[model samples]
Target: MAEEKAAENTAAQAAPQVQMRVLGQFIRDMSFENVMAQKGVSGDVQPEIAVQVNLDAKKRSAEHQYEVAIKLNLKSKAKGLEDILFLCEIDYCGLFHVEGVAEDQLHPFLLIECPRMLFPFLRRIVSDITRDGGYPPVNLDNIDFVALYRNELMRRQAEAQKTEA
Candidate 1:
């Protein structure tokens, strides 16, 4: 019995206990506008589209819970036309249970992995909203969170260097 108990404890220690789960998802804020609805849908005009994405995370409680938010802003306008075609902004958030992540790894896991997990649902909401607003679905491309994180780090470094100089 002593040997068995020792073996079990050893196995438990050797195995990394990591758990990540999405507890809930919600749209904190959403806005959709079709500014030129009166002008009607113009098939010939190819509008310019701009999209921006940002991620933020915060600790919800002491029990290894986190809330991650993904913000998406989209704007569309015709090249020559003065009126805007459409605008969409959404702040989508997810409550997550994260455990067994090292302190150094926590930032990346929250920013990259948590957002990656929530992205598909957020994308779907954007698409559906756009389509319902009388425009074609604005399909969002898959985000490269790793690249984004690196770029953010570089930007911060540049800013720090500028301040020091």
Candidate 2:
């Protein structure tokens, strides 16, 4: 009886229930304007673009979980003509099971690579959208995920400092 109880207890304890945590993550939001690219140079007309980025974060129900969301807004024009062809927002997150990890490791995992994993898929979708728009493919620039994360940290710190002061 004792051995059976011990075995049961061991099995329960050995079960993988360490809990999930976001060690770190990275996110990227970009836009490509192939129509503008084509008509601007080809038609000898200047193509103007307005690009903006918004970042946000949230916590999941799990004890050690987090999500960093990036939103991108882009608009293109040709010689003051309307070309509002692309409007998109990418909201995706990774399920990270993190335990026994240091903060240094966790931060980068959530801030840098997580977004990198989701970016390719998002990019492919955006490229296809542009291609289908009867223009060349809109390839996104390689993102500086590390820099973006650092900037977010700095901005948050600055806001906190202001609040405290």
Candidate 3:
């Protein structure tokens, strides 16, 4: 029994431990255009907003370092009219030092987990920008990273299938 216990301990020691750290985070690019102000349009504001999110991840030149970015696009318009309200676009990125994640899992970890860490900061920026832009603060809904990842995978698979056919 003692020998078996020792063997188990040795096996555990042989496995690599996972470590992840956020080295830094920042907005790579951002733009806010107040279309209503730009056009000098005046009317009752019943706003309908559309949001799109895209994520990208790439390994940095440094070992165990990766850069992940989230691109957010938002357009707001009056609910019943064709007049525009505002447009906001931002690309937020994080620098991460990651080690010990399996090769197969690294891509998902970078896209999903890194974004989850950086989202609150990005959300705050969006809220501030909207409020300062003369519109009500737009508090973003919480993103579902896992669902996003799965959907992206499904999209890629469908595209590949279309290409092959």
Candidate 4:
């Protein structure tokens, strides 16, 4: 009976209608700037950027939905106070299928899975742009998308509470 139940559970999980997921991806936008940086660094420019990554996710359609786009903007500077070393904007997009998936599962697919897949590519682009712009390669630390999403939720909740108060 236990073996039969396990088989039944596996069959249920294997159903095509029960799984919704992101499939493939393409780049929507990528831009890099460094003219000011070239002159302003005044030295090797060993850049230290105040990196602020803001992530946004949405479903583009109704059917097996899309995880939508991941946008990253980086503004770099040399020393503590200096002109813009460079500003890079990377927009990474992916195909996501969400039909038959719970809203809870879908949420992580967008915030975690989609970005996780795109992050390495985004990081590479950022590094290459910086290197090509005549600076040392920019290496970014790993991002925790789950934590970011949770913080975004808490921030929205706080704003809602503030409005209520």
Ordered from best to worst TM-score, the candidate numbers read 3, 1, 4, 2
Cα error of candidate 3 at position 21, Å:
0.7
Which residue pairs show collisions in model 3?
none
Tens digits of lDDT, candidate 3, 1-165: 999999999998998888999999999999999999988987679889999999999999999999999999999989988888999999999999999999999999999999999999999999999999998999999999999999999999999999999
Q: What is the RMSD, in Å, between candidate 3 and the native fold over all Cα? A: 1.8
lDDT of 4 by residue, 19-136 (tens): 5455877778888888574565466655667677776677666666675677878887766667677888878787776566566677766677678877887788788888897777
lDDT of each: 0.90, 0.60, 0.95, 0.75
TM-score of each: 0.85, 0.56, 0.92, 0.80
CA lDDT of 18 in candidate 2? 41
The per-candidate count of clashes, in order, stands at 0, 13, 0, 3
Best by lDDT: 3
Q: Write the per-residue lDDT of candidate 1 for residues 1-165, one digit (tens) a residue.
A: 999999999999987798999999999999998877866755665678889888899998659999999999998998877668998999999999998888899998999999999999998998899899887788899999998888888999999999999
Best by TM-score: 3
Which consecutive 10 residues in model 3 have the weakest lDDT in total? 38-47
Q: Considering only N, C-alpha and C atoms within 3 Å, which residue pairs clash in candidate 4?
A: 21-97, 22-96, 65-98
Ranking by lDDT: 3, 1, 4, 2
TM-score of 2: 0.56
Off by over 4 Å in 1: 1-15, 38-43, 79-83
In candidate 4, stretches whose alpha carbon ends up further than 4 angstroms from where it belongs are 1-22, 37-41
TM-score (C-alpha, index-matched) for candidate 4: 0.80
Worst 10 residues of 2 by lDDT: 84-93
